[model samples]
Each structure stands twice: as structure tokens, then as C-alpha cells.
Target: MDTEEKSNQLELETALNNQTLYWQANLKLLVKLLVVWFAVSFGCGIILVDWLDQFTIAGFKLGFWFAQQGAIYVFVALIFVYARQMKILDRQFDVGDDDSNQEPQS
Candidate 1:
């Protein structure tokens, strides 16, 4: 292949590789967050209610806290955390707000 075409191909390959890596990282982050979510929601709320109820925060029981407000708060926090982390990941992978990072073939 000619120099210009070969250069273009190389650039495309680099961006695609970075994109794949970015997705994998994002998936890992999502899985971690979900696991934590489940732990707080189900593990605390249902599985360990008797143990958690011993320490009441405010008037509500601890397990009730996990089921009612804690899980919701944690979910909101997770949303923002995921967004912030992905933005950092984007920059780390050289996938910033630049057209060159997009697929070159289309």
C-alpha cells in the first residue's frame, strides 16, 4: 500500500484498539459498581438485617436504612462516579473530544 493509505490504516487501527480497551475498562467499572450496589441493597437489606438492626442510625433501623434511603443514595452516587471515571478513562486512552479518535473509515 502507498504511504498515505498505510498511514491512514495505522491511525485507524490505533483508534480501534484504544476504543476496545476503553470499552473493556468501562465494563469492568460497571461490574464493580453493580456488585457493590447489590451488596448494599440485598446483602445489607435482606441477608444481614438482624445483624444490621443492632446499630440504628436516627430513628430508622439499619436494614431499613439500606433498603429505603441508603441504596437510593448509593445509586445516585454511582451514576456520577461512573461518569467521572469514564471521562478520566477517555482522556487516558487518548479518546478525548477529538474527531481523530473516531473510526476513520466511515
Candidate 2:
């Protein structure tokens, strides 16, 4: 093949591979969000608060915090954190869109 033809083929292959990578990164981030969601909302919020309250992190009340504000703050922080982490993950996969910082739709 001519050099130009080879270059075009290579570019096409790269684009298709990039799309596959984007979807993989998207899937991974989605799974991570779900697990963290369950852990915070269900684990801390409902199942383990009483037992967790037996101990405190920095003397902050555990169960009350879960019921009141702590879990919410963690959830909000996770949103930003996941946004940041997803950017890294997208770059790592070499599939980041121009807006890589934006998290993918679940």
C-alpha cells in the first residue's frame, strides 16, 4: 500500500479502538459508582450505623452523622472525586474525549 493509504488505515483503526476504550472506561466508572453508592447509602446509612456508631472517626458521631450529614457529604465528594478519577481512567485508556473531565452517562 502507498504511505498515504497506510496512514489512513492506521488512523481509522486508532479511532475504532478509541471508541471501544471509551465504552470500557464508561463501564468501569459506572460500576465503581454503583458499589460506592451502595456502600454509603445502604451500608452506612442503614445496615451498619448502629455498629459503626460504637466507634468514632476523630470523635465525630458516626450514626448520627450518617443520618444527618456525613453520608451526604461523602456522596457529594464522591461525585467530584469520581469525575476526577474518570478523567484519569479515560486518559489511561487512551479514549478520553475532548470533555474527558465530564463523567459518562450511567
* lDDT measured at residue 36 in model 1 versus the true structure, 0 to 100: 87
lDDT of 2 by residue, 1-106 (tens): 6999999999788877877877887788889887988887788878988987887766666876786777788789888988898777767765557674443532
Tens digit per residue, CA lDDT, model 1, 4-90: 999999988987898899999989999999998899888988898879988889998998899888988988998899889987897
Clashes by residue pair, model 2: none
How far is 75's C-alpha from truth in model 1 (Å)? Answer: 1.0
Tell me the spans in candidate 1 whose CA falls farther than 4 Å from its real position.
96-105
Global CA lDDT computed for model 2? 0.77
Find the candidate with the highest TM-score and give its number.
1
Residue 88's lDDT in candidate 2: 79
lDDT of 1 at 82: 87
